[model samples]
Target: MTDPIYAIPDIHGQDALLDEALERVARDGGPQATIVFLGDLVDRGPDSRAVIERLMQGQAEGRPWRVLRGNHDQMLLDFLDRSVIHSPRVASGLSWLNPRLGGAETLASYGVTAPDPEAAHAEARAAVPQAHRDWLARLPLWHEAGPLLFVHAGLRPGVALDRQDPDDLMWIRAGFLDHAEPHPWLVVHGHTALDHPAHFGTRIDLDGGAGFGRPLWPAVFEGRGCWLLTDSGREPLTPAE
Candidate 1:
């Protein structure tokens, strides 16, 4: 029998929720299970640092955890490395540190203050350790396992998986979300922030809007089927019959 694969989506700095989700995974899948985090590990919650650090420690301790890069994670990197006010793929004037995306909350997790937003760049650089930055930068854009492809966001329709743009992988919403056709693999992804994990016939969106006070639901995949790894137990997930 194939080992079950576990996936968590869009933590968004809710470390407590993350802990609960992981505990459930461990209970169901045990300590040796492989977990794929669907990105947006930072921003919008109270403890981005705690979330990142926990994941980092787990990976360092030889846990089979795969982390993907989210658009918001890219925003923090852009600010620290390029001093950009916002992500180039995003709107012209939208700063990452803006209250909406919760970059300020992320910075606060590192003990850096974003009083003026612009002026907090140097402080953020100093306060956030280089190891953490390196880990974030090194996060892969996607992870493919068997017939499932785990990515931060849905892929662009009609584009070959290898040919898909990195920006589209992390930030896309338009064509990818609306497209009804099935791709080569089951695109398991987050970033859309739905109220619940939605399993379209062609794909599964596991992002339960943990960034917006929703639960950080983890999912288990076995062969072609999926289930919600809730506190009570595994609940089979599928498109409406």
Candidate 2:
């Protein structure tokens, strides 16, 4: 009697959006659904801190949930998640791309501000919460859900499924997205949001860009059968009973 697992997609700091989807999962799951987040928990939105807090709160309550790292999280991790840019050059000429990745808004969440847009990103990165840095750095790239292997992104072409590296597991999205070849595991992923959920002959795409009002979706696997759970106001791929 294995309880069904609900595979979540990349969040990108939209807490309100995520809550809508989670409420749906709670209603459908009945305390048995294990929520496995596919990473990219922060960036491109204003609620990165709130997102992590809510996720941690749920985890503390024994509501089965697992968090993985996404590329945005990796960027902060590589930069030490606390390193900031202090150069004057970036102030007026070179604007930082932090907002697109949700970093700028998050910085403001902590009462932190930059001398310039770029400096704001830098100072905030340098001041990222310590607890968050460790959590992001320690996250593994993927998870094994019974017969499925969940990655933040997807596997590289020509690489064996079991031998995929953590970096690729967390960041490889280009080739994997273009790859039409069949995969061994039902590699559930969320990094590369497509025009819609792609149904490759051998793989299932559930990303569908949750942060863009698409909703943080969770895939419900019924043995070999699969379906989706989202709050995007669209009918699910199947009726979620």
Which candidate leads the pack in TM-score?
A: 1
lDDT of 2 by residue, 46-92 (tens): 78788888877787788878888877677656544335322232224
TM-score of each: 0.96, 0.81
Task: Count clashing residue pairs in model 2.
Answer: 9
Error of 1 at 46 (Å): 0.9
State residue 208's C-alpha deviation in candidate 2, in Å. Answer: 2.1
> For candidate 2, what is the TM-score?
0.81
Clashing pairs for predicted structure model 2, backbone only: 43-101, 43-102, 44-101, 44-102, 45-102, 82-126, 84-122, 85-122, 114-120
- lDDT of candidates 1 onward, in order: 0.91, 0.68
Q: Residue 61 in candidate 1 has what lDDT?
A: 98
